[model samples]
Target: MISNAAKAQPRGASRPKGLETAARVRKAALKRFAASGYAAVSMREIAADVGVRPGALYNHFPTKQDILKDLMLSHMADLLQAWDSADFPEKMDPLERFVRFHIRYHLEKTDEVFISYMELRNLEPDNFDLVEAERRRYEAILTGILQDGAARGRYAVTEPKVATRAIIAMLTGIPNWYREGGRLAKHDIEDIYLELARKAVAPGATPPLTGDRMT
Candidate 1:
C-alpha cells in the first residue's frame, strides 16, 4: 500500500534530499505561472528560478505542460470529489452551507484555481479538454448544490445554473485580486465572498430578468 503522505510510492520518487528540490520546483512553477502566466513562462526559466538545470527539472516533471496539467488536475480532482463526498452543516441553513463552501475552496486551492482559470488557452487541445472536463465537473457540483437549495426553498435564484456560475465567478475572483499580505485578511475575503454569494441567491431577488435564466 502507498504511504499515507503520498498517493503512490514509485521507486526513486521519495528521498529527503530531493523532496526539497521538488518542492522548490513546484513553488517556482506556481509563482512563475501566477506572475507571468503559462504561455509566456518556459521550463528553462522555471528551472533556473528553482536553481536546477533545465534537464534536471524533468526528473520532477516530464514537460512544462505536464507540470501545469498535474498542478491543475490534482486540485480539480479534489474539488470534484470533495463536493460529492461533502457533509454540510446540519445546524446552518442550506444557503449558509453554500457560503461555507466558497470560503473553504478558495483558501485551500487558490493557486490551482488561479492557474486553471488563466491558463486554459495555453494547454494543447487534448490536455485542455482533459482539464476543462474536470473543471466542468467541479462546476456541476456547485450548480447541483444550488439546484438542491432552490428546490428546498432555502435559496431563491430564478436560474440555478446561472446563479451557480455567477457565484463561482464571484468567489474565484477573490484570489485574482486578493493579496496574502493585503489589507484584508484572507478569512475576511472569504467572508466577503460568502456574503456576496448569499445575496446572489437570496430568496426573492427582484429585477427585470436578464441573461439565460438557467444557463
Candidate 2:
C-alpha cells in the first residue's frame, strides 16, 4: 500500500539528514583509511566517496583529524559495548568466553581492526590519548578476568596485565591471514585459538613448540 514516492526515497531517508550524511562519511572514511593509511587519505576523497561537497563534509567534521579521531574512538566504543552485551553463561569459564567473544568480534570487524591499529600513529596527541584510554579500558576487562582466574587457581598467568596484552595480540592477528572459505572454518579457527590460549595459561602446561603437532 506504500506510495511510489515512499518507495523511491533512498534507503535510510527517514534518518535525520545530518545523521545520515555523517554515517556515510564515516563509512567512506573507514574503507579508505583501511585500504590506504590514514595519513594517505584526504578529506576531499572521503567527501567525494560520500557524494558530498568537501565544504559540506566540514560541517560534520571540522578537520580530517576529527574524522580519524571519531573513527578510532567509535570503534573502541562499539567494541566495549559488544563485550557488555556478549551475554556469556554465568557458569562459563571466563577465559573461554572472553577468547570466543574477542575472536568472533574482531573477525567481523577486520577493516575497523586494521585502521584502529595501523592508523593510531596518525591521530593527534589529544585524540590519541582519548582512544588510548578506551583501549586501556577494554584491556582492563581481560586483565580483570585473568586476575580472577589466577586467584582461583584456574590459570597460571604470573602477570595478569602482561598476559592480557599477549592474548589480545595473538587473537587480533587472526584477521591478517583469515579469509572467507578458508581451509579452516571460522568456528574451527576459534576452537584452535581457544585451545592454544588455554594451554598458554594452564597451570604447569608447556606450550607446544612449532612443528610439534598441528592438524
Candidate 3:
C-alpha cells in the first residue's frame, strides 16, 4: 500500500525553486501586460517586477512573446480544467450552470481575461494560432451546450455557433466595466446577466429577481 506521504500533493506544494521563480515571472508579467498593453511592456520591466535580473528572467522565458503565450495558454488550460471540475446539482439548468460558472470564473480572473482578449494582436502568428485553437476548444464547450439545449426544445437558438459567440462576447465584456465596490455586488451582476442570457436563448423565460434590472 502507498504511504500517506507518497500520495500526490496539490499543485505548487513542492514545486522546484526554478518553477517558483517562473511562477513569479508569470504573475509579474500578467500584471504588467494587463496594466500597459503587451507592446508597451518589456522583458527588463518584467524582470524588475519579479525582483530578478534580466538574465535570470531570461532563464525562465526566452522572450516576452513566450511569456505572453504562456500566460494565454495557461489561462485557457486553467479555465478548461476549472469547468471540468465545477460541481452543480444534476437538476440545475445546463445553461444556467454555464452562465454562473463563466461569470464567476471570469470575475475572479479579470486580469487574465483582460489580457487574453486585449492582447491577441501581440502574439506571433504561430503563437496566435496556438492560443486561438485553445480558445476555440473553450468556445466549443458552450456551442455544444447550446446545441444540446436547442435540440431538447429548451432553448430557441437557431444558430448554436453564432449564439455561442454572442453569448460569450456578452459574458466576457463584464470585466471591462466592473469594479469591486460597485453599486451591484458580483452575485447581483451575475443574476442580471443570467437573466439576460436565459432570455436570449430561452424565449419567455421569466427575468431573474435582481431588483435593479438593466434598461
TM-score-sorted candidate list, best first? 2, 3, 1
TM-score computed on alpha carbons, candidate 3:
0.86
In terms of lDDT, the best-performing candidate is: 2
Candidate 1, residues 47-116, lDDT tens digits: the string is 9998878999888888998888877787787776776676886787655665567667776777777787
Backbone clash pairs for candidate 3 read: none
Report each candidate's C-alpha RMSD, comma-separated, in the order given: 6.3, 7.6, 8.4
Model 1, 122: alpha-carbon shift in Å?
Answer: 0.7
- Report the backbone clash tally of model 1: 0
Q: Write the per-residue lDDT of candidate 2 for residues 1-215, one digit (tens) a residue.
A: 99888887864575579898999999999999988888889988998999989999988999989998998999999999999999889998988899999999999999999999888888889999999999999999999998998899999888888989999999999999999997999999989999998998899896645886767
Off by over 4 Å in 2: 1-15, 206-215
Q: What overall lDDT goes with each candidate model?
A: 0.77, 0.91, 0.91
lDDT of 3 by residue, 111-170 (tens): 999999999988999999999999999999999999998888888887888999999999
**C-alpha TM-score for every candidate:** 0.74, 0.88, 0.86
| lDDT at 104, model 3 | 92
Off by over 4 Å in 1: 1-23, 80-88, 108-110, 180-188, 208-215
TM-score of model 2 relative to the true fold? 0.88
